[model samples]
Target: MDRSSPAGNPLPAADRADGGREECASEVKAKLVGAKRWRRLRRLLAGVVVLGLTGWFALPWVMPWPAALSRPVPAGMRITDVHGTSLRRLLAGGMRAETPPKLPEIPKALVLATLAAEDHRFYRHGGIDPVAVARAARDGVSAGRRVSGASTITQQLVKLTVPRARTLRTKGLEMLTARRVEMIWSKDQILEQYLQRLDYGNLHLGPAAAAAGYFGKPLADCSLAECAFLAGLPQSPSRLNPWRHADRAVKRQQWVLNRLGVLGWADADSLARARAEPLKLRRHYGFFMAPHFVDLLLSSLPETSRAGGENLTTTLDLDIQRTAERAVASHLARLAGKNVTQAAVVVLENSTGNVLALIGSRDYGAADGGQVNGAVARRSPGSALKP
Candidate 1:
């Protein structure tokens, strides 16, 4: 059957209705397909987010926490004489170091300067600074080489505790370890450990030592300029040595001060004062006494006990030791004409045979064989043995 309108002829009404329904059904099918695709995409994205969050949360548990942090003596060990005078300080692994300052004793200005210079976002970041990492990446891409680093204080601490060659693998491990460290340690604790073990130039191991070595003063007496000066050394200790490379160190120091001012850690007036202040570097030697005897005593103890911060008192008397050293020096001077290069002396208590003093050599600082303990060394038994 055909239908006719007022102006034109048309197909049957049933056929028209059937065509309209078919078009509507096709549109509905298309919409359904698009919705399914959208849902699938959303699910995929959700899965990726879930996996990322899981990994982020679980990494600290899976990675190994550094054992060095739990140990008490990351700073090093100290050896004192009978009268409580510091004789020598042995570093964490028996190397020589200056006595470290307590964390609370370090000045606030130095802490601020360090934060400004090394990691401004130290408090905000967990273990890594995403902003710094992004900036480093962008700069590296622009320069076609690595011009800077993104390591946080936490990461630096991890690297210090577990030293490794600079490689991608090492960096990844450091990142993981740093994350673990942050979980176990507070910000102040991390900072204390880092500062205590920090190696300043010329064997100055900590803030107190650096202050004394560079300015011939204690950490408490260091001025703001001196604090800023020391806060800038750890970047490259050898290159920024104020003693050897004053210009470089000063430049780095100015940079640190500028950062402090810009970051609001220091006021403009202070920064100005620091910039104008002259840095006077002086060489300060560590307290070194009875070197050979200390060495022998430390060697005899178990390695673990050396760093326990225990004061070891011996029967050796300071007066007797000084007398014995003078005697050895006098005897050596007399034998200087006989080609004799070294001398040792040992003073024993009359009744108990306890060694009151032992002079290993004429001079421990001597270059050639001056550390040889002649008293303990095997020598030809001359008539001297016939007491």
Candidate 2:
């Protein structure tokens, strides 16, 4: 054909037409692929926008931001000796009081130990730690078990203040609330409140009560070792209680010290010294000298006052309370052979009608209804009431 002469080569019209058709087919295929890519990109963008919108609007409803970060501190009757020194706390309905020492008054060692044990990044993170969470998730997946916790100090504090069921929804709420708590409270303030509100075993709530209950020392007076020991209690308070399981408690304390060492808060020498330091704990029943008197005082308080963290000062004398307890025990011991099993004593000031001492039972440690307040028990005074 004339096409061959133009190019100086032999060519057929059918072949030329076939080549054009092939090129057109390729273009059509490319356009189809491009359309598919555009559709996929559009879908991805739409999904992201929808997710963003959902999170932005749904978060508030899920978390429901609080007006204030203030939580109810556990309140109890802080009965003292006649000379005004703290004798024992009478918890309201067995609830420990949240008597946190002032932040300045709390020992620095204790604060550091607590931070090391509970949340190493307490000062750095803003409520939630994505890195920790991711690591925890990875570890859990690798181990084929959920072994670690990713909750920050703020998140733990939120959980404590606002108890909820353990679920994905609750976790989402906790994350949101923790962020809100961070916004409302300073880091130091949040820490102080957390320490004060934390529960220790044996009905000891807060650092101050825990210090006194476990070590028989004031919060500021706790040694580094003791501080570490106390700092570890909040994790599993009942299981690791020093009174019940001293060895386990010591092990947990060592774990805390190791954490501190890793965090550069303590040196090898210091950690060793702390480990060697023996804990001289003054363990006793939850109720100390004036169990009944404390119970009575707690019962007498208004519900609002008890829940609002009010402290009660009573006329009960610690020394007299001890004496009464001893006398009751002695009389009961003597009467044991005569089938007399229980006794109660109530000593009062005649002039002011103030209760000076109250012995609820012969032995509050005894298993036979020891917790029952004999002083308040309903009894018929057969001949004694005749007068």
Candidate 3:
């Protein structure tokens, strides 16, 4: 009863069953292999993700977060007049003050100019701007040089707060710190701090100092053209120094104005007016008026306060000091023919040791030992020490 094929061969049932079993086994093995491969791939992907997360969270530990950001701003020695107005700022170790003068609500023109000059999408971005970075890269490639810096204001703040050498690692840290800063501070706060800490050539730090140094006015009182000029200095303070290079500084100011116009922040008439506005820059002889008093105040401070940024209200009357200086100069001029050149004067309040007027020398401008403070200079006490 066995079935025969058309070729006249009888079929074997056991051989057919064995062939079917072998085929089923091969299919099962293939499936198991595929499953194993998928599981291995998933594990590899998961490990990569875990490592990336670990690195992102742990990288800050390698360099350690800067403690300077958390500590109180080290304001250098600020010598103030009796009226509490700052007379001179003696920088401690050449470091700027951490707490700058209170800046008024930033002018709209200044804000627009800053945004146009620095980062246009400052309000919209988080901490980093990938689009700007990509564009900078492309531009750099095309120009064969770095045409633009793709740093956000937040990034600049981080760099200013925690200075480091320019490197890949440092830039990575800046980005990480910038993100943390954004999370902790508001956009306005960030901008405020940036404006407060920015440099404006000739050792002028912050808008307040820059305003006074450049325009002989307060930050709140600076005009629009002055504001624009101040706003354009943070990029390269030395190169854009208004004192050394007025023409270049004006050009940069014009550029800022142009940017403002392009952004619709300024109208054509206003822009033209600003461009034509003349800058009346005052000469900045920093800390010149009260040099001796400043030195005494600095020496009297504690080691901690000597680190700078302290506002010291001395018992010095500026008017009386000027009078004493004039008197000394007049007397010395009269005695010039007698071969007497140097003189010192000190006036104190009758009730207290408060110094009212101090003339350290006849003339601070005199070429002969003008810097030697005669008030505290070591000399024979004469008959005064006898009693």
- The 0-to-1 C-alpha lDDT of every candidate, in the order given, reads 0.82, 0.80, 0.77
lDDT of 2 by residue, 1-387 (tens): 244636688568897787778989999999999999999999999999998666544454556654335544656656576767575665644756635476888899889998998888888887888788999999999999998899988988888777889998989888888876787679998898788778888888788878877876667788889999989999999899777898999999999999999989988998899999988989643446677777677677666665444555678888887788888888888888897888889999999999889878776777998878788899887899785
> TM-scores for all candidates?
0.76, 0.69, 0.77
The residue-by-residue lDDT of candidate 1 on 107-226, one tens digit each, is: 999999999989999999988789999999999999999999999999999898888999999998898888878888899989998888788878777787788768878799988899
How far off is residue 127 in model 3, in Å? 1.0
**Least well predicted 10-residue stretch by lDDT in candidate 3:** 95-104
User: Over 4 Å off in model 1, which ranges?
Assistant: 1-23, 75-77, 81-83, 91-94, 98-102, 289-306, 314-387
TM-score for candidate 3, residues paired by index: 0.77
Candidate 2 clash total? 0
Model 2: which ten-residue window has the lowest total lDDT?
65-74
lDDT of 2 at 208: 80
Residue 289 accuracy (lDDT) in model 3: 66
Best-to-worst ranking by lDDT:
1, 2, 3
lDDT of 2 at 14: 90
| Model 3, span 1-387: residue lDDT tens | 455556979758886677678989999999999999999999999999988765555443455454666664445677777877666776644644434654355566666777777888898987788889999999999999999888999899889888789998888889777766776678987887777677777877776667767777656776668778888888888888887888888888888888888878778888788888888999754565667777777677677766546677888888888888888878888888898889888889999989887777766777997777898899987999785
- Candidate 2 Cα deviation (angstroms), residue 98: 5.2
Report the candidate with higher TM-score, 1 versus 2: 1
